[model samples]
Target chain A: MARTAGSDGERTEAAIREAAVDLIARHGYEAVSMRQLAARVGVQAAALYRYFPTKEDLLFTLMREHMEALLGAWSEARPATTDATTRLATFVANHIAFHIERRSQTHISNMELRSLSPERLTFILRLRTSYEKELRAILRDGAEASVFDLDDIGLTAMAVIQMITGVIVWFRPDERLSVEGVTQTYLSMTMRLVGATTNRETQHVHAGTRLRA
Target chain B: MARTAGSDGERTEAAIREAAVDLIARHGYEAVSMRQLAARVGVQAAALYRYFPTKEDLLFTLMREHMEALLGAWSEARPATTDATTRLATFVANHIAFHIERRSQTHISNMELRSLSPERLTFILRLRTSYEKELRAILRDGAEASVFDLDDIGLTAMAVIQMITGVIVWFRPDERLSVEGVTQTYLSMTMRLVGATTNRETQHVHAGTRLRA
Candidate 1:
C-alpha cells in the first residue's frame, strides 16, 4: 500500500507500531499490556483501542505486518536469474540485509508466535511456509541441475535460514565487519556448504554483483 | 545437586522448576510471576521464596543451570579422537539430542536472557562463550590440520550452533523423521558447511559412524 506522506492518522499508527515493536521485543507479547503500550506512545488507552481493538489484535498486526514486509522486501530484491548459484547468493544477501535492518520486528516475528491465536497463527505460518518454499525451490533446482550438492533439501533450507537469520543476534553496524563483509563471508560459506558444482562455474559468480533492484 | 528421592522439599523445588520452565516458555519470562509459578507447583508464595529469594533469582538459576547442563553434556559427549571432523560430528549430535529433549528449557534459556540482571547476564554469557569457544577450537584445529576449510572461525561456529540448536523449533519425534534420521542429515550438512577436506588423510573420517554416545 502506498502511503501519502505526512498524514496525522498514518503518523499516529506508525508511532504506535514503532513503540509496540520495541516494547514487545523487549518484554515479549504476553507481558505487554495495551495500557502500557498506550503510555509508551504518549496516548490515551481509548485512543490506542481506536487504532487496535484488543491486545491480541495489536500483536497480530505487528506479526502480520512483519511477515508481509519481509515478503515484499524479498519480492522487490529477488533478481531475474536462472543460475541457481546466483539465485541462492542473492537470497542470502537480501535476507541478511533485510533482517539486520529491522532487528526488533524480526525478533518479535520469531519469538511471539505463541501469543497468536490458532487461526492467526496459521495465517502467519502460511506466510512463513511460502517464504521458505522459495529457498527450497532454489535448492531443488540447484541439486537437479548439478550446480549444488545437497543431502536433504528440507534440512538444508532450515539450516541456511537459521544460519543467516542468526546474524541479527550478534551483529552491530559498528563491528569490525561491514554488512558487505559479513554478507561476503556468509555467501561464500553458503556456496561451500552446498558444495557448488564447479570452481570454474562458481568463481565467476559474484553474489553482491546481482542483487535485486 | 544430588536429590534425596521422596524428600518433600526437593520434590517441591523440582516441581517448581519444571512448572516454571513450562510457564516461562509458554508466556515468556517477564509475563510469568512467582505467584503463578507457586500456584502451578501447589506451593505457597512464601515457600517459593524460601528456595528462590527473588523472581530474577529464579530466572538466573534456570538460565545458569541450562548453560551448565549444556556444558556438562558436551563434556561427556566429547570424543577421545583428535580428529576435528569427529569432534564436530559429536557436537552436532549431542547438541541436537540435548536440546530436542528439553525444548522448553532451551526456549526459556534463549528467549529470557533479556530479563536477567546485568551481572547474571554476564555470567550466563561467559558460560556461553566458553561453550562456543570449544567449537571455535575444533574449527581452528581442523583449519590448521587442513581437515576443514573455513572462511571465519567465529562466524562458522555461530552458524553451526544456531543451525543445530534450531532443530528443536520444528522437530517432533512423531513426525516423518526420527532423531537418527534428522541427526544424519544435519551431520552431513554441518560437514559440508565446513567444507571437510577430502584429502587422502582427512577423507577417511566418517561422521555417521562415530556419533550418538
Candidate 2:
C-alpha cells in the first residue's frame, strides 16, 4: 500500500487510530468494520484502507504501539539506582499511571490479542515478556538482597502486573481516589505484597527519593 | 417464550449455551449473532430465540449464572471458623479453582459487560458487588482482628480478586503447574500480600485446619 504524506496525513492517521481504539474497546475487535471506523473518523473507507490495508493491520498497529509506548515510558521512569525497592516502587507508579491514562488502549491491548495473526501475536508477546522481565529482575534482586520476600518470582511478577493493570477496570479520576491516591495505595499494597520487611526500609527509600526531589 | 419439553430439549439448551460461551469468548459479544450461534449448535435461529428471546438475554443469563455459580461455590467452600487468614486462604483457592475450570465462561463474564443493556448491566454489577463484598468483609474482619495488615480493605480485596482471577488467562491444564500446585503458590502469595504478621499465626491457623482434616 502507498503511504500518505506530511502533517495532514499524520493527523488523519492519528484520528483513525483514536477512533479505532474507542470503537474496538466498546465492541470487540472482530465485530468492528472498516466502514464503521471510517465513519467514526469522518473519512472514507478507502482513506482508512490507505493507512491500514486490512482490519488486522490496524489492530496490530494499536497493540504494538501500546506496548512500545509502555516500554518507552518505563525506560524513562526507571530510576538509576540498584535498589530493588526503589526500582519496584517506580515500576508500580509508572505502570498505574500509564494504564490509567490509556484505558481504552490498555483494554484493546489486553482484550484483542485473539484477533491478531500468529506472527503478530508472537511479536506482541515478546514485547510483553521484555517489559515483564524488567520487573522480574527487580523482584529477583529484591529477593536475593532480602529486601523482599517472594516465594516464586514468576508468579509474583504476573500477580503484580495483573493487579496493577486492573486499576483501569474500576478506577475513575472523578471517584473518591485521585490517581496519586490510587498509586499510593497500590504502592503500599505492593510493598506489603513483596514483603518489604520493615517500615524503616520504606522510609529509607522515600527519604532518598525526597532528597533527590 | 414457550418452554421446551423433555431431556432432548434440555440437551439442546445446554448445547446452545456452550456454543454461545465459546463463540462470544473468542469474538466479542456484539460480533456474535443468534444465527451464528444456532448454526454452531446445529439448531435453527428460531430455536435459539425459543430459549433466548433476545441476544442480550442470552448474554445476561451467561453473566448472571457465572456470578451465581461462583457465589454458590464460595458458600460451599467457606470455612465455618472466623480465622481471617483461613477464610482468606479458602477464598483464594476457591476463586482460582472456579475460574480455571470455567475458562470460557470466565472470559465471557469479564470481557462482555459492554454489550449488555443498562438494566441487565445493573443486575450483573449488583451480583458482582455482592460477590466482592464477601471478600471485602473477610479483609475487614482480618484487619479489625489484627490478623492481617492491610492498607485499604476495598483496594486489597480488588487486588486479590484480580490477581487470582488472572490465573485463567495463561494457565493450562497440561502445564507444569497442576491446579493444586497453582492454588498453593497463590495461597502463599496471598498470605504474604496481606501482611500476615507471623509464621506462628500462619501455623496456628494451619494446625486447626490439620486437626479438622
Best by TM-score: 1
- Stretches of candidate 1 off by over 4 Å are A1-7, A198-205, A210-213, B1-7, B198-212
Interface RMSD of each: 0.8, 0.9
CA lDDT of every candidate: 0.84, 0.85
TM-score, candidate number 1: 0.93
Question: lDDT by residue for model 1 over A148-204, one digit each (tens)?
Answer: 988888889998999899888888867688887788788887887787865634533
Error of 2 at A157 (Å): 0.3
Candidate 2 C-alpha error for residue B10, in Å: 1.0
**The 10-residue segment with the lowest total lDDT in model 2 chain B:** B204-213
In the range A109-140, model 2's lDDT, one tens digit per residue, is 98889898999999999999999999999999
Worst 10 residues of 2 chain A by lDDT: A204-213
- DockQ of each model against the real complex? 0.78, 0.81
Tell me the tens digit of each residue's lDDT in model 2 across B139-194: 99999999888888898889999889988878786667777667777778787778
* TM-scores vs. true structure, each candidate: 0.93, 0.92
